[model samples]
Target: RRAAAAQGTSLYEEEEILLALIGGKDYNDDSKCKKKLEEYCQGLENASLKKKEIHEKLKDLCEVGKADTKCQALKTKVTKKCTDFKTQKLEQAVKNPSDDNCKENERQCLFLEG
Candidate 1:
């Protein structure tokens, strides 16, 4: 759907701008970065849970023929976006290679694997 595609494109563009802004800053404190990453991961997890809940509700509606195909499509889009964000953060952690960043990256890997 053109609307979903447009939304994805806008989301990607917005994330790019946000990353650009963040990359411009000099993070001398690894603790701060680690804290931020933790918060971000938590937020991502919460968002994923909320999306799942919404999908289930929509699925119930669909079963009654009250919902359309857009619900699943939106879930897919959101999952992809979250994945893209995680990948980008992992790449940044690899580039920095701080102790905290490494731990965070490992934690993320385990989280993803599990």
Candidate 2:
């Protein structure tokens, strides 16, 4: 449509308009998908950080005393974040299994799981 409007004569075919719309939609979808993948990556990083913090806290508590009162809650938080990260990556994989991002996420999930 923009291409047609920019033309000196302003002549445009219906098919050209439709194709432009379709092309724009495809570009938008790709952009959105890339954004989603970046968000998932950030989520995974956050979850890893949370889990590491919990581990460090647990270590500190163990060094200071034998009390484990807060251990369960911390464990639950780590588990939940790990699960959420994995779920997002898995969903991305299912959506675009052949994509590099999906494959990288799969690898990251496996590493995180182990």
Candidate 3:
């Protein structure tokens, strides 16, 4: 998306596949699964925004020749948040594929393997 690009971030290919899957779903008012998926995905998006903010701050600090330890700490936080979000999403997709609109794109749910 344009927003992600503006933030100097990019979605992974797997996320694109996931998006295609979600796009195919019927998002009616009665679809509790869709609602839940939306909420979960929203959380992921917020996490991504936070990561981007951290990156921007780190860039600013680097430009000013700040402490390496501060940058390292921020990088660690970003890495942990990214890892946790990915793991949670993959597990959700595998455990509730339909809820994630992944039923039709099951093959793309690599997390389901092993």
Candidate 4:
């Protein structure tokens, strides 16, 4: 209908517009099928718009090593932080439970110091 309005022809009369509006196996050019195509296009447009909007919302404007002060989502914030360090620490801590040097250093130089 929109294509027909835009170019003054039915969807079939405007071959390119019809094809452009239609996609893969989910919809065809029959009566009910065309209705389905229009509905799918609306849904696709809405989802695309939402994805673009979410990309904008999740965007971080920080330099290297700087946390996004305003980004409060734990999952997203963790993506920006160093998880490699946590994995490395777990590997080391598991491999040698009695590594006093690492433990003592962390005790004095890490949270204990702060």
Clashing pairs in 2: none
Model 3: per-residue Cα lDDT at residue 97: 59
Model 2, residue 47: distance off in Å is 31
Candidate 1's TM-score reads: 0.27
Candidate 3, pairs of clashing residues: none
* Cα deviation of 101, candidate 3, in Å: 5.6
The candidate 2 region of ten consecutive residues with least summed lDDT is 14-23
The reply for model 4, stretches above 4 Å from the true place, is 1-69, 72-77, 80-82, 99-114
Best by TM-score: 2
RMSD of 4: 24.7
Local distance difference test, each candidate: 0.41, 0.40, 0.40, 0.36
Distance from true location, Cα of 28 in model 3, Å: 43
Ten-residue region with minimum lDDT total, candidate 1: 19-28
lDDT (Cα, tens digit) per residue for candidate 3, span 1-114: 544455454433333233323322322222442443455446556776444554332223322323333333433444454466558665666676564355333332342231
Backbone clashes for every candidate come to: 0, 0, 0, 0
TM-score of 2: 0.33
Local accuracy of candidate 1 as per-residue lDDT tens digits, 1-114 = 244354443222433223222222212233443344344435546766454553232223223322223332433444564487578887787677787775444433533332
Task: Kindly indicate the candidate among 1 and 4 with the higher lDDT.
Answer: 1
> How displaced is residue 63 in candidate 2, in Å?
2.3
Candidate number of the best lDDT? 1
